[model samples]
Target chain A: MAGYLNLLLRLTIWFLLTADLSWDNLLLGVTIAVLLPRGATNPGTLKDWLYTLGEVVAAIPQAYKEAFEIMIYPHHHEAITLERAKPRRTPSLLFLDIFLITFTPKTIVQHYCEQGWYEVHRIQRRPTP
Target chain B: MINILSDGCMIIGLVFWFWGTWPLLGQRSVLYKLHSLSVADTLGSMAIVMGLLLRIPHEWPLLLLALISLAIWNTVLGYVLAYCSTREIGHDG
Candidate 1:
């Protein structure tokens, strides 16, 4: 499953680079995509993949909102907070979680501890009237 | 109509860039500055790239790829920098 996903991702990059849809180009792309060695086996289910993708899509609007809110100059509170992670969370999920949090302007994940805690730096901005 | 939308995108992106960059001169911490930079550099660049895509639909493949790269790389780079810097600072030290 992950192999097919990796293939699709590689193919997208190939198509974007070549920017052509000729039959020969398509054949060549498919050949290259298939022939390329896969990365280290990453444990992920299709369901998990779709869920992560959905979460990412949802975070886009939230990120924009946070970006605008952070621009507001007001009395904001900054703090270092510890967020607990799921003990069994996989590396890919951890990556996505860190990305999503940091992508928003309000919070950043500074480090992930072996104890399953995320040290987060967060800015709490008050809404202006 | 399309022209207006493309122009609007460019303008919005410019606004983001300005606002995001404006905070660097203040007394904000390094993390806060990084957050702002990501918003400006990543999201703002994506918006500008999209505006260009609307303007030059023929070169969409390249622009789209650039948009994706900007978004992902900027986000990751910001995280990595923050993670590394804060680590060396000894957390709350």
Candidate 2:
């Protein structure tokens, strides 16, 4: 399917670029490709393809700035006292939001199944609504 | 000579890819194709950068920026792809 092919391509690209196709990297890439939102409306038209391309292109600078910020300052934020609060809402922009946060240092993607929520764990928590 | 060789090698990689890889895989899947092309773009530019770095040893700052930029880009792409894929496939359905 389109999804599988994309996974293969992403893996091949990473292998080609880094000159480090160790088993570890290959396994990691395979794991990621398999984990990607598959069948979530595969890009079927020229427009879809263009949109995906633009998304990737847009990720570069946003990621860079995040990296810069994390590097200059590494501190933790407050924690979520209550799990059900909308303040703990998952990112609305989905991939872009996920990319920005993970790209920033000291933050990780933690999946909480008790509430079935995916939250960003920052160094420090921010005031929530 | 180095720049020429670098360009030539990249071209060769492209050729090998189009001729050898594409036909074998069948390029109908847009996600797959884009993923592969992302790899190509990342590697293709990386090679050119590396070649330039080798040729110009004095521009350390520029080289450092290039390396950092690429690293950040790659990491972000990986994270986005993983998170989006997970949420889309796992919880959405």
| Chain A TM per prediction | 0.83, 0.39
Per-residue lDDT value at B66 in model 1 = 96
**True-vs-predicted CA distance for residue A2, candidate 1, Å:** 1.6
DockQ of each: 0.79, 0.06
TM-scores across all candidates?
0.90, 0.33
What is the TM-score of candidate 2?
Answer: 0.33
Fraction of the reference Cα-Cα interface contacts (below 8 Å) that each candidate reproduces = 0.77, 0.08
Across B1-93, the per-residue lDDT of candidate 1 in tens digits comes to 888889998988899999889889999888878877877898788788888899999998999899878877888898889888887788568
lDDT of 1 at A121: 84
The residue pairs found clashing in candidate 1 are: none
In candidate 2, chain A reaches a TM of: 0.39
Positional deviation of B88 in candidate 2, in angstroms?
25
Q: After superposition, how far is residue A126 of candidate 2 from its true place, in Å?
A: 6.8
